[model samples]
Target: DTAVSQTPKYLVTQMGNDKSIKCEQNLGHDTMYWYKQDSKKFLKIMFSYNNKELIINETVPNRFSPKSPDKAHLNLHINSLELGDSAVYFCASSQLPKRLLAGSYNEQFFGPGTRLTVL
Candidate 1:
């Protein structure tokens, strides 16, 4: 039973093509996140949803969007992908404590990332 799972673990597409990655979590967590890891292995949060409501949206390109139909799922869609869009996308879920301070970190369960390659 994978706590967090993503579809199409590997994606190779040409530049300017659009793509979407699906994510699901069976951990029953109220919060889910989409993170992008670049070639340098720097991870940045793209979006976060808590109880199906957008909470944290980072300053990613407008071409990226996150959709969450329910608390247990989050999908990322990228339009007009470019060469710089090539990276490993990760889906993570965590049960946040009631009072999360500015620097608080919750224990997150991450899915096997989807590696996207834009040629």
Candidate 2:
């Protein structure tokens, strides 16, 4: 079984259309993250949920939102998708330190990724 999985491996949509990417993890991790990889392959974190609580929300547009129904699931919803939204969205999970101190690292399990194409 995949430790992290995302639905709709490829998504092709027109501009201004709304879309959502569902992600789930079977690793029972305490934290889940949403990342966007641009055409340049620069991965940037958009949002993170720790134990179902929102944390580490980057300076993403309000059109993007992440909802976590539970610790094992985190879904990314984009409203009024724009051409710039065309990128690979990844879902990752990890068991993190409760206090989030410096120099602490945990291996994150990443999903296959959902490629969003806006035309």
Candidate 3:
């Protein structure tokens, strides 16, 4: 079984439509995150949830929302999708890293992303 999984891996829609992507992880992690990969392949974090509580990245737009119903599931919603919203959205899960030295964290495990296209 996959440790992390996403639904409806390919989404193609018009510029004004709204859509959602669902994610689930069986890894029993305490933190979950959403990341967006642009057409240029630049990956950036959008939101993070720890123990079902949200910790939104300040730079993320209000149009993007992340909801975690439980520690194992997280979903992302996008409203008024625009051409600029077209990107591959990835879901990842991780646990609090052990204090390696002072400031570093362990790498997160990413799921296969959902590719969204807005035309």
Looking at candidate 2, what is the lDDT of residue 21?
99
Candidate 2 lDDT tens digits, 1-119 = 98999998999999999999999999979999999999999999999999989988999999998999999999999999999999999999999856787887868889999999999
lDDT of 3 by residue, 32-70 (tens): 999999989999988888888886575977998888999
Better of 1 and 3 by TM-score: 1
Q: Give me the runs in candidate 1 sitting further than 4 Å from their true place.
A: 97-105
Query: TM per model?
Result: 0.92, 0.95, 0.90
lDDT of 1 by residue, 2-102 (tens): 89999889999999998999999999898999999998999998899998888999899899989999988999999999998899999999997445877
Model 1, residue 9: distance off in Å is 0.5
Off by over 4 Å in 3: 97-104
Assess candidate 3 and give its lDDT.
0.89
Provide backbone clash counts, one per model. 0, 0, 0
TM-score of 1: 0.92
